[model samples]
Target: MAAPAVVRDLREHWAPASAQEFMLDDVDLGNRRLTIAGRVRPLDDLTLKLLLDWLEQRRSRWPNTANLHLLIHNQTADTTGRASSHWISAAMRGQDAPLEKLRVDRQLEEALPHGPDPLHLAEVFGLDEKTPMRYADSARALMERPLETDPATSP
Candidate 1:
């Protein structure tokens, strides 16, 4: 028999995990306010995208020297409230190492200056929105409900 469909899946069940590691501390982008989702658990696409934009924007505003510093810097913690400290550190030290680190940081800094932020990373990468619930409450509220159209009722 086919495996039971994963019950809640990413879209239905799953709550955000609240840890200091995943908390978004202070992210200020001029007059524009970015809604931070998944403070408690892994972030969804909307959250990740906004974060990438913010980080990249910051990276760009600085000179090449600062960019280089970011490339070499080992981030034990993300004061930016973007991701868990462990994830951030791992990503920094992961394969492609400095390049990956630079890319992530650059993404965040670049996103900071923009308005409305970009669509979440999930939408971009085509990943399932299987994020934990930490952001769900907020996400549900923010997203517009799809309008239901009855086929029997002609437009």
Candidate 2:
């Protein structure tokens, strides 16, 4: 499968583990929000709509699942279990480490454009302030560097 498809499948498989809940009603569609480990976060309109549609379809397919958890194994009937950090690391078994690179690229891009407000980054990305602060420092150093230009190559 393509990388994007793999990522999407992994994301869907991991959603219940990340959110720590199984009930479709746990998601507050009317408010366009979802809670992750007790922290409430707003959802983009597209995500909210897609989730609603998925839930509706799931409900129709499995009416008895209304009171049960959202993600259940088709054969085993077990809740989608959480993956260990070791499992995640093994899953990204590649020299390039695409997931790590994507995270770093996103942080740098966010920092470069905004001058790196660590607090803002923490709130917006639902991350710890320390991580954003580190990104902010990197951004500051990058902003201080002068661009190197060669006079010989000037047009």
Candidate 3:
């Protein structure tokens, strides 16, 4: 199946620290969903296909192991487990600025045009309501700025 433009772009440019770290379980794939930091979300078709491919490759390499963990360094318990945040951060260093920055920027950008609905932003981004409220305040401040061309019409 053809991937979406955004998915294709991400696949081509950004390689995660460990592809396995982002792996999903059979249940998740079956439902075409994901749960991150306790937030359940739907997985797009392209992402689900990519995940299945990765899982197949991993299974081929270690057919005897019973490890159900998505990401694994080795078949042994000592090495096989989830990837660390530090490792993920390091991997993202040269690829882009901190992942948090990218996430915040995307969130703020999305909030800006829509008048910054804190509840919506929080739900969509899986962030605390306060976080979105902070960005909403900033967006409101920017909107309050007086336009040079016509101060009365500004904001």
Candidate 1 lowest-lDDT run of ten: 1-10
Clashing pairs in 3: none
lDDT of 3 by residue, 105-140 (tens): 666776788885887677666666478898788778
How many clashes in candidate 3? 0
Tens digits of per-residue lDDT for model 1 on 1-155? 11111111111212212212222242333423322252223444554454555457545643242222111122322222333323333332334445434433433443334321344433322224542122333344344456678889957
By TM-score, how accurate is candidate 3? Answer: 0.55
Weakest 10 consecutive residues of candidate 3 by summed lDDT:
1-10
Off by over 4 Å in 2: 1-16, 20-22, 76-97, 103-115, 137-154
TM-score per candidate: 0.21, 0.54, 0.55
Error of 3 at 61 (Å): 3.3
Write model 2 residue lDDT over 1-155, tens digit each, in one string.
11212223234323324633434555787888766556666665555666666566656655564235443333312334432334333434564546656566666766788886897667655777588888888888888899878989978
Q: Model 2 — TM-score against the truth?
A: 0.54
lDDT per model vs. reference: 0.33, 0.55, 0.55
Q: Which ten residues in a row have the lowest lDDT in candidate 2?
A: 1-10
